[model samples]
Target: MNNFIKNLLLSNFNKLLQSTKIACPKENLHNSNRLKFYNPGKVTYDGKLNCGITSYLTSFMLSYHNIDHKVWLSKYGFGDYLEDHVHITTNSGLLIDTTYRQFFIDYRSDGNCDYYKYLFETCEPIFVGSPNEFDLLKKSIERQNIKVFGSLNQDIKELSDFWKQDINITPKMNLYDMRKSNEIHPTLLVEIPSLIQPLIT
Candidate 1:
């Protein structure tokens, strides 16, 4: 990646981390408590969780720049827990993780959380790692490379069709802190981002 472009990606991702809130519930229709990490931008509010959603947002930005990237799923997160760990590697030779602090810098409970009443943002959520961190992660944890994409489009129709359930999303404060303010990402208001990684698409 060009220095300028890498800097730009970092700057924008940090802005999103400090400015946006994710609507990821403890329990969704699919998994145990994950909001389909690919598209946790809905409502229910979480920060330290959903690295995949963070990756999607970052990958979305990369895609907007016409940068190709690949998504990967880590069976376990940085900490020793079965957290929803998913992130991306860009063709620019950068490993970007906007939601990394959730495990490394913040507190993660073994089970259950009260996100509605709690503010999970303790420190800055931006983390751009070199090959070292990526190498360490590879040796320690188990993960799989899913798919690479030139761009990812929101598929709300597909999710709605498959779920066929009423989404009772409660509002919350800044999770990623993109600071469109009052709620979440400005883009998320209009375009629903795709989930982190569903079993199928």
Candidate 2:
């Protein structure tokens, strides 16, 4: 993409991100202690659940903006499992989904999650492409008729119809390491715009 377009996308993304509402429950002592992983015989002290709120929000924003993103979903690392970050190439300005992180609350039905709301609030401008997961979340959030701010993808109606009968959805993932690889070579700044055509108007 050209410099002008890239700058415009960045500007819009920042504006949207600032307006999104991504809130999390405070980490309390009890919840903190429950974060340890356990095995049948030897329960190792694994650690806290990573916070993917930021990473997921970034990806969601990129997707909403119609920008091309490459996400990296990695295995659990130090600290919380959800604590992931977004990476944008300095030159090409492409987005990547380095990881897929989601959270579930037992008290709520499928998709009605704080995690999704947090992401929606954080990743501004880009409307959520009603992935089945997102529809389920929307249903869950409607108890109070809360207004959703951004746009919904054109496919939302179909996804809602297809997923309406399927209430039992589970969140699972294969964690990959998201750390930047050794600097084998310098980051490239290609002018190729095909990969990101979806994001640009």
Give the TM-scores of the predictions, in the order they appear. Answer: 0.42, 0.25
Q: How far is candidate 1 from the true structure (C-alpha RMSD, Å)?
A: 16.1
In candidate 1, what are the lDDT values of residues 1-201, reduced to their tens digit?
Answer: 556556766456534443233324342211123333323431222345555455555655555556666656555234764334555565666666555433321122221233211212322235455557645543222111111112221221111121111221112212223322354244444223322112012
**Candidate 1 lDDT score at position 73:** 58
- Measured over all alpha carbons after superposition, the RMSD of each candidate to the real structure, in angstroms, is 16.1, 18.4
Residue 25 Cα positional deviation in candidate 1, in Å, after optimal superposition: 10
lDDT digits (tens) for residues 45-69 of candidate 2: 1112322333333444444444454
The weakest ten consecutive residues by lDDT in model 2 span 168-177
Cα lDDT over the full model 2:
0.30
Which segments of model 1 are wrong by more than 4 Å?
A: 22-46, 77-81, 106-124, 133-201
| Cand. 1 Cα-lDDT | 0.39
User: Which structure among the candidates has the greatest TM-score?
Assistant: 1
